[model samples]
Target: MVVGLGPGSPDWTTPEVREALNAATDLVGYTTYIDRVPPRPGQHRHASDNRVESERAAMALDLAKRGARVVVVSSGDPGVFAMAAAVLEESADPQWQDVPVRVLPGLTAANAVASRVGAPLGHDYAMISLSDRLKPWEVVAQRLSAVAAADMAIAIYNPASSQRTWQVGAMRDLLLEHRKPDTPVVLGRDVGGPTESVRVVSLVDLDPADVDMRTLLIIGASTTAAVDTPTGTRVYTSRRYHRR
Candidate 1:
């Protein structure tokens, strides 16, 4: 079974995910996510570093095929830029085709972050990952340009990482071409974790240096608005409606 841990917050982990983890004889995932799972008495944990998803998925499938209940874990919703796709892709191999696999969903970072801010995603939006590790920078750039041209709110994942630094700035500059310099942008880091923070800024003021692997960037649409209340500022994309 593949399960999403839903960030590192205990409050965000679903009961179904907990049940899977508790019953699994083996768990496989990246070192960070695997560490999130407590050491179960009889369960074996196979932890690998970043970018070894295929090997990790194969391990889980092998364990399941051997009659062991195996759980493959991802940080957020497995289907959203996470391990579920990798596992499903690997399962297509004839050797692992018969292994029964179940994927349990969890809250993705986009939704979590969007909720923290008012509702930047309430209108038409697109989710894109800025990571060029799997693809090319040119491809990502084209997609960003197209999405910006469409004036869709964008939820950017993996905006900046240790090795890749320029994409986030490039994204901001591209969006600036189509969006106002003062367009609201929300930065969500360590979302749902104890140290989680959500801050709003402008497109021109957004600094890629402030973002890391765990941060998610939300570039609001042209219609997105921000209002300051006594308590704090709230941002949302107005859902246009005409009263009859």
Candidate 2:
């Protein structure tokens, strides 16, 4: 079963998701996401290194081929920018073709970050992965520029890592081309677990040095504005508003 974990908060975990996790004989996921699941005895675990989708998919397929009821977990909804794509792409392997593959939906990192930053995604928005580790940086830059030109709030995933540091800055510069310097930016790290961190900043204040693999950046659109109220100064991307 694939579980959509609804971000990293414990209460965000759905009852059915917990039951599925408990029922599984084996768990397979990226090391970071796998670590968030509470440790349960008697379940075998196979953790994958970063960016090893093919290997993880093959391993999970192997266990499932042997008739083990394995749970392939993705942090958010399995289908969103996560392992579900890897699993499906690799499922073409002859031995794995007919195996039953179930996908359980979890809250995506985008939704998690969006919630913390008000309704920035309340209107049409785009989610892009700035990590060019797998895709060409030029392609990523083009998309960034396009999204900026179109004025959509963009949820950027995998912004930077030890080896992929420059892309985030490049994305920032690209967005800056069509966006004002003060656009609201939301940075989320470890969204649902004990170590989670969420920060709201402006585009001009975003320091690329602060990013790591665990962080996600949400860049609000031109119409997105900060409002001062008794609760505090809040930034919102209005669902009731859009620009042509």
Candidate 3:
């Protein structure tokens, strides 16, 4: 079973996922995700680096084959750029053909972040990962350009990290070619975590230095609007599109 733990908060974790974790005899996942689950008696955890997803999937399958009740944990929805795909890919192998797989959904980072800042994704939107580790930079750039030209809201994941720091700025530049400089951009960092912060800025003011792997960016469409409420500012894309 592959379960999503939601976005770094116990309140965000679903009861179904909690039940699966309690029933699991062994847990296999990235070290950071594994550490999120409190240790319990008789349950064994096999944690590894984040980059070894294939190996981790195989390890979970091997454990399940040996009569262990294995659960693979991931942050956010497991099917959304998370462990579900990796496990399903590994399960296609003839060696693990008989192993049964189940995926449990949880609140995705995009939805969690959007909720914190009203409905920036109220209309058509695209979700893209800025990381080039698995795919080439050219492909990433092409997708960004296409989405921008289509005038759809965008949810960007894996924007930057210690090793990768330039992609966000490049994205902002490419987006400017198709979008307005005053386009609303929402930055959500560690949403649901203790140090959580959600703020809005213009596209031209989006600095790469402010983003990290933990940050999720929402770039609004041409129809998106930002209104200053009594409590705070709320951003949302218009549900009705105007005829061009």
Clash count per candidate? 0, 8, 0
Per-residue lDDT tens digits for candidate 3, residues 1-244, read: 9999999798999999999999999999989889999998999999888557899899999999999999999999999889899999999999998899999999999999998889999999999999999999999999999999999999999999999999999999999999999999999999988899999999999999999999999999999998889878899887999855
Candidate 2's residue-wise lDDT over 127-231, tens digit each? 888877678988988888888888888999889888888877778777888989988898889876778887778898889998898898988898888776776
Rank by TM-score (best first): 3, 1, 2
Q: Who wins the TM-score comparison?
A: 3
- TM-score of every model versus the real structure: 0.95, 0.92, 0.97
Q: Which pairs of residues collide in candidate 3?
A: none
Query: All candidates' lDDT scores?
Result: 0.89, 0.81, 0.94
Candidate 1: how large is its RMSD?
2.1
| lDDT (C-alpha) at residue 212 in model 2 | 96
Better of 2 and 3 by lDDT: 3
Weakest 10 consecutive residues of candidate 2 by summed lDDT: 226-235
Candidate 3, after superposition: displacement of residue 90 in Å?
Answer: 0.8
Candidate 2: lDDT of 131? 71
Best by lDDT: 3
User: Which whole-number lDDT from 0 to 100 does residue 163 have in model 1?
Assistant: 89
- Show where candidate 2 strays beyond 4 Å: 229-232, 242-244
Q: What is the lDDT of residue 200 in candidate 3?
A: 93
